[model samples]
Target: MEKLLISACLAGEKVRYNGQALPISEPLEEQLSSYFELVRCCPEVASGMPIPRASAEIIDGPASLVLEQKAKVKDNQGHDVTDAFVRGANMALQLCLSNNIRFALLAEGSPSCGSFLVYDGTFSGVKMQGRGVTAELLTQHGITVFNVNTIQEFIDQLPLVICNQSFINADFMK
Candidate 1:
């Protein structure tokens, strides 16, 4: 079976910044398990962040800028945590490379794992159009990334990919 990288919280791991887990519905979980081996990760925790830590967001600019070292990620408490976010992203990339994983299902709106959108650094519940640190890095490396809301799309594409024994390009899916 092909492998799929996933956010730990989505798999019932209590590793979120608020120390909460957002496990998917049991039926959906079973459906995913039937298709691929899930490799779970909590990038923030893996980067040595404590559970119940203050929420962080990409500050100064978008995550792309952060990846380029021109921006930063800061917690709500006004502490810089850019390095930890980037480190966790690198760890996620390495895990995908070593595991031959081509797909990721990460938490949306997270500073580390959000694939489609992330908080806008104001801590006022605003979101911006952009990828998070890990999502941007993984997509750059040719991995297909999906967030919780887009799992159905991933499932829809799985048959074509598995039957052809090749990874489907993100473009083709779009």
Candidate 2:
């Protein structure tokens, strides 16, 4: 049996910065409900923050935010949300490494769970190439994290017979 590390918001939780849940495909939702166990997390919440909170940014880099206090998630209310993002990312990593979690499905364009195109924190929807807080941490620990669209691609790469699959030097070239 395999387990999936899923963003809690994808499971229809109201944990997004604005208190909305992202769209989840029904098949994937059903798959999660029936077969695999989910180690769900909302890094923003796990890190520390109330729902319907303000938004923050990774001003320099996710790592820099962790080091300094700049990478923050602030709402329009002018609150500092650095701790919540950090705390959430750390907890997700612990869950991934300490448990049997190998694959993670994250939310894209988020300050906490964004996979590839995170916002520049201006609320202008200007996206830059970056990893979200929890996405970065989980990836560093060897968990393969992806957004919903990439899920099938990852699955397709796995051999149907994982147990007896064999590889040779030629396989690496392709």
Candidate 3:
């Protein structure tokens, strides 16, 4: 079976900053289970942040800028946690590479996993069009990242992506 990297919280793990698991619909879970072997992870937790940890946001610019060292990821208490975020992104990237994972289903609105929209660095619940650190890195390295809200889009594009012989014969869309 093909492997899909996923946010642990989306798989019912209580790994969110508030120590709660995000809700996952039954259909989405069924689709994921049918299509791929799930490899779950939480970048914040992987980076050593505790459950119910301080919320963080990208500062100065988007995750690309942060990866370039031109921006930062700051927690609610104004602590600079840029290093940890970057480290976690790198670790996530390594996991994908090691597993030959080309697709990722990441949590939305997160400083680490957000694939499309992320908090606007103000911690005011405002969102902006931007990818998170891990998402940006994965995209840079040829991985396709999707937010939970975009699962159907991901499924639609899977056939085009899995044209290679290794995945062409797999029962990925069952």
TM-score of each: 0.92, 0.81, 0.90
Pairs clashing within candidate 1? none
> How many Å off is the CA of 103 in candidate 2?
1.1
Write down the lDDT of every candidate, Cα atoms only: 0.88, 0.72, 0.87
lDDT by residue for model 2 (19-43), tens? 9998588887775544356777887
Pick by lDDT: which candidate is best? 1
TM-score of predicted model 1? 0.92
- Tens-place lDDT per residue, model 1, 62-109, is 788888999999998899999999999999999999999988999998
For residue 93, what is the lDDT in candidate 2? 84
* Candidate 3 per-residue C-alpha lDDT over 1-174 given as tens digits, one digit per residue, 9 for 90 to 100: 788999999999999999999857888888777778999988889989899999999999989999999999999999999999999999999999999898899999889999999999888899999999999999899887888778787676666656544373324533
On TM-score, the candidate that comes out on top is 1
Looking at candidate 1, the ten consecutive residues that score lowest on lDDT are 163-172
Error of 2 at 153 (Å): 1.0
Native-vs-model 3 lDDT? Answer: 0.87
lDDT of 1 at 17: 86
lDDT, model 2, position 106: 94
Better candidate number, 2 or 3, judged by lDDT? 3
The candidate, 1 or 2, that scores higher on TM-score is 1
